[model samples]
Target: MLNIQNTKLFWASCLALLVTSLSFGIRAGIMNQLGIDFQLSTSQLGTITAAAFWGFPLAIVVGGFVVDMIGMKRLLVMAFIFHLAGIVLTIFAQGYWSLFLSTLLIGIANGTVEAACNPLVAALYPENKTTRLNHFHLWFPGGIVIGTLLVTLFVQLGLGWKVQVAMMIIPTLIYGYLFSKLDFPVTERVSSGYSSSDMYKAVLSPLFIFMFICMFGTAITELFTGQWIGLLLKNVTDNAILLLTLTTGIMVIGRGFAEPVVHRLAPQGVLLLSAIFAAAGLYMLSTFTGNSIFFAAIIFGIGVCYFWPTMIGFVAENVPKSGALGLNLMGGAGMFAVSIYTMFMGNFYDNLIVKHLPAGASLSVYLKAPENSASAQALANAKNLAGPEILQATLIIPIILIVAFGGLVIYLRSRKKSRSVAL
Candidate 1:
């Protein structure tokens, strides 16, 4: 039976996460508008977006280290303040610096949510750490679906991007209220009587380090692509936002029912399979277009469905001594890598478009040309040509993960065999 107090805390954590992902989805939806309104280039927009990612690691890593000292409640309260400030600042943002600063604040809030809630959930349901964490994380994609659908609805109703962004405030306030009224518990590491020194030692272990490195691959494969999907697929489909919605929608359902898969494959086995599908799906997305892209999206969604939570779960189960610090560090590393990659991706995408443009035609010149004119057509062709190549470029990350996870699975099985033989 579920304990009433823990259940309430769990749902509040979910609501907090919902707020975090809603920001992501809304930002993805508004990227084009921000570019147009601010006279910003894709690279500039990516920098603003990258702020959210890079800032996340800063707060999460710091919160992880200090959460035990300051308490989860305090961290969450900080999240509430940051969320409100970030949202209001973003709604009023003027240009690059303002947008970057606001996004950085929101990213910090997002990280704070994870820093407190991940360990909270793990502590709340110690017996089912992996499965429960998957359930907890389902909200990441779930909130994206909500945010994207809201963006679609608001856009259709002739509402501006500012209005769409303001929608997040409703949930943010509710989560704040929910969190304030709750009584919090100590983290599992503390409850289990482990020392902070033990956590530090465990995080530096070879196994933990290996997983930390793998986090970069898994996170980039999942988040970077998700964030950029609208731009990447815009040339190929008018309903690009729907594709993001569809992809995350699949993730929602898959994660909701993740227990069976986790039980059957084990975490490492599941990761190996996820990496395989992610690589294949990403490559397929690069190659496919039009209605056929939906098929590719399904495969891609399935591949990344278990990645974030499962990676955390693996560390929690396998590296218990590392505690909240380990979980937060894993998440921090992933976001930090994505931060750097987002900038590179934006720059690479711009370069690709420039490479594909006709001789004597610059992107700015073509962009300002009359719609349906020869110059506009040239720009369209460039986007179409350049987009797929970018997706293909990202294919290498998942491919590397396939080998890494496969080795991990084999090594783990060998260790199990050795123990059984000795017994």
Candidate 2:
């Protein structure tokens, strides 16, 4: 233990994680709400659902540069302003464009928070960087647990999703105020005398590239499953909301336990095993159609629990020279993965399977028309074709990527040991 007394720093980092996680939580909770409220077609739904992810890459880049140029304090403030503004915009969003734009703004804030806090936590506890990082990430899924339950309650109480979204502002405001009083450490690019060239070199290394591949798979696995779980569950189970809550709740619990688990297994071993389970889980989720489908989700969640944070934590442990640049690069690369996966998968899913209604059918007809209309027939056909089986099978992309990343990591480690022996 590094005699850690900076409770403020730790909690502030957790709050940042919580804020980012809740964005996904609220978005998942309200995704269906948006479709119903806006009478969106499946294509429109896919685009809007992926809009938040589209902002992530830019947010990561801009936030990192801003933190380097200005400071984490200023970046945090900017992120909070953007987050608050986006949340408000989303609550009152009238149509597709507004929802897309608002989510992009929120994505910026989410990415900024990650860019700032990840490096901050690593600096606060240099010796226990990975452990602290994993612990900090616990709040993310933890926040999702809270958000899921809260939104479920609100819906049951007849408050609607808008009110549920507005509740996030309370935490945003509180965290913003608390962050104001804390001392933000200078980013590595500033304190360590790393020039732009050095940072670029750090980013271009084989190690960095391998980690980036892991980041891509982790981001795809985390977001696609959580975001689309509701859709997947609905295809197999009657109570989609309850099943979603259970799956998310289990995910949170698994993340909570990951710190201790990673400590024992080591990051590499854990990641290797995680890939195996993740592949099997995705295969199960895809091939199985019964209530047993959720069992696969559980396994998938457990396997991926340590994947994302451990990717960042690996850099913190191994790449000290990269400094804040390392942490920012991790966040940037990870969210960039999110942006690409969301855009690619969502669009492909929509155009390939979701678009087009039956003859004489439109968005309005799907929303308010009788059950026997052509719109209903078209929607049913679309839903049936694009069912849980197909959606879960799509997860094979991440599972395959995970195996490749594992092989890459293995090759890198072997090469490093061989070089050391020659030296």
Quick one: best TM-score, which candidate?
1
Judge candidate 1 against the unseen true structure and give its global Cα lDDT, from 0 to 1.
0.93
For residues 1-423, could you state the per-residue lDDT of candidate 1 as single tens digits? 349999999999999999999999999999988987887877898899999998799999999999989889999999999999999999999889999999999999999999999999999999889999999999999999999999999999999999998999999999999989989989989999999999999999999999999999999999999999998888898998888899899999999998999999999999999999999889888999779999999999999999999999999999999999999999999999999999999999988988999776677777567778988788888988888899999999999999999999999999999999999
Model 1 stretches astray by more than 4 angstroms = 368-373
Lowest lDDT block of 10, candidate 1 = 359-368
How large is the C-alpha RMSD of every model relative to the true structure? Answer: 1.2, 2.9
Q: After superposition, how far is residue 176 of candidate 1 from its true place, in Å?
A: 0.5
lDDT of each: 0.93, 0.72
The Cα error of candidate 2 at residue 300, in Å, is 1.1
lDDT of 2: 0.72
